[model samples]
Target chain A: MPTPTSSEASGPLAVETVGLTRAYDTLIAVADVNISIPKGSVFGLLGPNGAGKTTTIKMLTTLLHPSQGQARVAGFDVVRQAAQVRQYIGYVPQMLSADADLSGYENLLIFSKLYRIPAGERQQRIEETLSFMGLSEVARTLVRHYSGGMIRRLEIAQSLLHHPQVLFLDEPPWVLTRRLAMPSRNTCGPCGSAGGLRSFSPPITWRRPRSCVRLWLSCIKAGW
Target chain B: MGQTLAVAEAEVRKLRHDPVELLTRAIQPTLWLLVFGQVMSQLRGISSDGVSYRDFLAPGILAQSVMFIAIFYGISVIWERDSGVLYKYMVSPAPRWALVVGKALGSEVRSLTQASVIWILSALIGVHLRLELGAILGMLVLALLGSAIFVTLSLIIACLVKTRERFMGIGQLLTMPLFFASNAIYPISLMPAWLRVVAHINPLTYLVDGLRTLMLTGGSSAFGLGLDFAVLGLSTLLLVVIAARLYPTILT
Candidate 1:
């Protein structure tokens, strides 16, 4: 029930959900939730399974309608201005949304076309995205052949295809551990010979408006 | 529009990754045509018109194929919702209508592919094709519009249900009834009075009737074509509006 603070009012908020509530019959999935996410930031909606993180993200992104209240993304109302809102955000859902029958590059091409990236620039963008995710080599391979980690990476790459102004990461607690367990751990060069080094990289990095980050960090630390 | 297209493109690409799935989706209808159509022909009194059973069965199978292809349209949405891809679409800047349109169009594209293959196979099996450019174009339009209606129906169902089991259960419950209730399996005149009423109301009946006219009669009757087009067009418009309205609400 936290309101958007004065500091967050200074810039364009990437996502704002006020009094958002979703109910099915008598079951309340997400109730009276309020949040504000700033532009250009990676916003993590973290909670236990079925904690309404996914539902909340859906409302903010215009996937699900709120039973009460409103959600706006990138300065557009998710309900009233949904098309404009969708044009500005990138969404990567908890499950693998990519077509397993398609090759990596083919998948990217489809998204490029959907996002209406200029026809002229689509090829370059596809190539760049594939390479960025280290998927260029496997670009021709069917996604079904992709490893679990590779699938997640490809999902991330697809979300960034259009360079969405706000990114929502609905990280279920279990998936977080698995994603963090990947070999993103880098050792200091000087300590390489010592066969050990502290894990310098945080398990996850969320980038959002400075004020929202502070509030988000505090919430995470509080174990909400 | 752009983002919806992107999601659709992704959906199409995913199809390539699973060749077996694509093969099954494409080949199942052909098998039905080859086996079921041939078997059903052996039954006495199956044909009301002078048309041979194979000829009579061809357009019906085509309509069925369109229905089958579209039935899975929302399967992707359900899978995406479970996998968080629906969440991605929800959060992205793409318009809700684009998402609906893109998914519908994507399903139409797949349906068209399967329908074309069936058309080719029918020709090989000696089922006559009118091959008039106008007829072919008309068939494609009908198929696309019909596919869009079915796909939208699937999306609405997907949005309403949360689990895959429930989605599949509801989908199965709806599809076959829809097929049987229509003129897809038999002519409306042959159906019982009560069932005939259902077929008259079933949108698929108009689609099948239109396709049959195009394939068999070489062109639809002016009245028949007008009724078919009007029903399909009106249904598509209503479904699109319902889908657009339900889309954002469902996300929450």
Candidate 2:
């Protein structure tokens, strides 16, 4: 295995995978993937739909065994010291994996207890998690009734409940559109003001107004 | 310890939301008790040491229910793997033992509930319990110990198998053989000479015999009790070690 670079060695690394690979029979889902994520950094894994990002994340999180090489999360080996590695990280899968039959509060409480948050702190932690996720009112409601966004938010909340040093989020941005849209609106508001207004009007008028309308139609056809 | 409790708590919470699944879990066993027991009682030439067919069938069906419940241990693990919940648990701070224990305990608790329901129905159908309190306690202990072994075996299978369809296919294929090969439905002597040898080797045969001895014989023989307990204890420990070693490989 290659040694960590000086910069990497100096910084606190949250996750590190060296030559990680996963194969199913003949097909390789994840090829040699080596990445170092810094502590507390909100890293985004960008790739096309099937670029093996989920597979890579699965190996790093100790969910799937690597066919080759090794990984460390929060300084613990993913293979040799998996239980220790699990101690410092939280994982939110791409799909909603919470028990649909369980109440939101019950789900949080179960995970909090599983993580071994002390008995004295469990009630407070569960309440705080529910409040943080904006699920306090409906905490008693079954998760099957929760909307997709609510389920996603609750899942994120569950990951944070353990106060993990590292969090593996498979598709955080797609589920966090509200947060992503805020910064972009502020930065690009002035530059696209005229175009935005013109684009907005065509939808209301339901009329194609030549060049700009063609662009709107094309974008719509692509299903952006 | 905490992780096991958490997973068990989560499973319990799931039950609260979908109590029907709990009912569904009991349904198959109940059918065996009600329909199959009645049908088997009428079957010719199925006698066990002068006991009525219902008496013999009760313990067999009980063991069978316990076995069926244990098989879900692997099925649930595969479901978690496919659906990604296993990943969540794998990366959590929960100890591996906690995960294994929690799942096993959860299944045990579910099976016990089903067992209790069946026991009540058995009582209603005139299945008598002649044993004193000591035998009742022995029966409970044996059921719990036997469940641990079966659950561990289920986990080993689950950790080794990746796909749901394959797991189910193999699980179903093994269920009847494991049941029949044991001294569950008929006494070991009644089985074919070869099958009698196979039944003697089956860990489940000891469990069923232990349960029957406690329930029917009323815990009279110290030697029988000791041998039964020893067999069950040893098997539980061996299967658990195998499960623990295999678990990390699967999760990794």
Candidate 3:
């Protein structure tokens, strides 16, 4: 594995991309993008559909390799040190990620092991996550039986199990609305929603972490 | 290592939630033993190496059952992709190889279930089986290796096709040829010269040959038992690496 760059050790940015680009044949999905997301602050990439919002997220999350240029997440280069980048971040994609055949508890337990969470903390954390996500009532129930809202909450709970430092949400406003509607007691706060990209939705200011939120509402709504 | 087992444990856990799926899957093999094996045994022209044709067919059916279960595993990967489980797994810290191994291990569990069902049915139908500790262990090892190979092959195909429809089409096309090309239903000696050569190279041949030798009371295989293990072991190692290499392409 390659060592981290010198600036990465003391860098102020949690995520940084310089001249990052991705292309398919002649279509440039993401092009020459340069942005810096500071640590501990909420940052949102606002653009219309196909404005490369999801593509940007994919590159940053190490799910899609950049066709050209560089990106670093948590001081590790996305292309060179994808495994290291994976260790520091949690991603909730546009789609639901849990296995419907398994129960809510089983989904979280599997992720706990995948993330190599210590065996001692696994059960405790799973229980806590279930309660936090409001999934405790249906913990043992198959995820296939879970309503759409419950499935999203379970996904959020699974992502947060390892306590990642930087969390990425692709098109989360719909879920965010539901999440915003969640009782304040169990919701992960706005500040924890770092490195997010909101596209084409009405921008609403959050009362909590008011200074931390950055909204991008730049264009007329386009198809995603 | 822990991650690999975790991946496998997830699959096994799914089985626990729907045990009926296992029982349902056994119906095909059970019918084969109760109907086809008995009907085929009446043909005296096909030599059975001194054991009853039912006994000869038992191990062949076992290999075929395992192959069918494993070859369709790629379809699950396609489902996982659509449902978001594959994406979740991709971003994890676990090595890609662990994910592949875990899926294969899970398939092994399913294969073993099918094997047990076949074994019990064979005993009930009066097929002469050894039932010794060594024979049972040998059958188990062959089951695991056979399942691992087919499961890895399924993953490779999933990576190449990237869609449920395409994967299913390819899976259906491949399973029949792979089954018939090998000695799963009959001995290679009965095959034409051209297919006999293909059977020599087919991995399934080794599995059936090994199972028939260990499973039957007085069975002898043209290929030795050690060669079966060697071929299956080598093929499994190579397929695992290939599957791991192809895993990342699944998202693209």
Candidate 4:
């Protein structure tokens, strides 16, 4: 119930971490670290496997509390103001996040409901998101039948449905740029300009022939 | 409550796309009625108090089947974790309690479907049932409550174990004791002193007692309707709360 105090309500940073740390028993999974990402820009956390990139994203998204240190997402404290943080962030983890059992539209609908999208706007938002992700064609197709890249797009669409301020994809494929380029249409471009989203994911870049938002890249190695 | 229902609705929708799964799951309960019920009915020593043994065992089998479905539900939770679906839910704005309750509510839908099948099978097998509106409604409530309790318990197990092997082992260990200790198959009078104590504490006992009373014409509850509901309801609420608290730990 703690509301984000001070600049958190309307800060320039989409994400910031100071001495952020997460440690397991006798092993530090994510050590003391600091990071800052400004609004309206993309920041990618780049590292090899076990570099704690997913763990860091998890902590910032309020899915995993930090073992020690301070972290904030979209101006809200990840731990003390996690509910507020969740409202402002969309997260796609490293693994396949889409529910394969349901159709693509059904998966988005469920996310829409979970995100508490306004009932009146839910349909419109879903359509826009599906189109944005180029999933409109297979909207009714079972997700299980979709290819891995299609599933990833649907998962991205799910995160974007809420129009989160900070969109985090833990480990999107490097070819995501090509995937997002399928449509010459401006998809994430509008959100970037509207102050609705900041992309955060290493190995993920969205490039359309017409427009692109540049990214700042960071790294964590061996739990550092 | 809306978020809770949304979580539950997602589950129901998944099954809705494949209704055959529900019917397929009913096969076990059908076997229980057609095979075990008939085979056990002829026993002379088991006291049924006048209502036929098949009729007595029908509710027990239904409750057992519900337990069987719910107790191993942790495996799915683990699967969701492995598949990364749990991450989507964990990071959602919905509270942990709502997510747990929502999953439990979905299990109720599954349990009720099986209950309907058991009702039809019981009738065909010549078990005289109450079939009255009030009784049917009561049975529905009992099944839902029972399913919620068991599924929530399953969720807690999922949180603690967080692995399929451990969860399956624990689930298998639980179902047998939960079944034998309950007054599902026989009167509580038949249990040993210690097991009678365990039966008194088992939520499954209350479910079977309520189901037996509501499903059959001559069926009666040893603990009375009020007590049966109170036990199941309170236990369910408690388990749901516990499971919700534990839900986040699975991620850790």
lDDT of 1 by residue, A45-163 (tens): 44456787767776776676678998876677878877766666666665677657677877677667666778888788788777756789999888889987778768767866775
- The alpha-carbon root-mean-square deviation between model 4 and the true structure, to one decimal in Å, is 5.0
Q: Could you tell me how far off, in angstroms, the CA of residue B167 lies in candidate 3 after the best superposition? A: 1.2
Give the C-alpha miss distance for residue A165 in model 3, angstroms.
Answer: 1.0
lDDT tens readout by residue for model 4, B1-252: 888988899889889888998988999889988987888888878998568898889889888888888887778889999898998998999999999988987777888888888888888889988978999999989988888888989999999999989999999999999999998888888888999999999999999999999998999888899999999999988998899889999987
lDDT of each: 0.69, 0.69, 0.83, 0.81
Tens digits of per-residue lDDT, candidate 3, B76-173, equal 99889887789989999999999999999988899999999999989999988987999999999999999999999999999999999999999999
Please give the lDDT score at residue B141 for candidate 4.
Answer: 93
Deviation from native of the Cα of residue B207 in model 4, angstroms: 0.7
- Write out fnat for all predictions, comma-separated: 0.86, 0.83, 0.89, 0.80
Q: Candidate 4, clashing residue pairs?
A: none
Candidate number with the higher lDDT (3 or 4): 3
Candidate 4, residue B165: CA error in Å?
A: 1.5
After TM-score superposition, the amount by which residue A53's alpha carbon in candidate 4 deviates from its true location, in angstroms, is: 1.4
Better of 1 and 3 by lDDT: 3
- Flag regions of model 3 displaced more than 4 Å: A1-10, A181-224
DockQ for each model:
0.47, 0.46, 0.77, 0.72
lDDT string for model 2 (A1-224, tens) is: 11122244323566777888899899998888887775533454545567788777777777777899888877778888777667666677777877677788877888887777777887887887777567899998998899888887788778767666566666543434352234321122211213222121111110111111111100111112
Candidate 4 runs further than 4 Å off: A1-8, A182-224
Find the candidate with the highest lDDT and give its number: 3
- Tens digits of lDDT, candidate 2, B132-186: 8897777778888888888888888878876778788878987888898987777
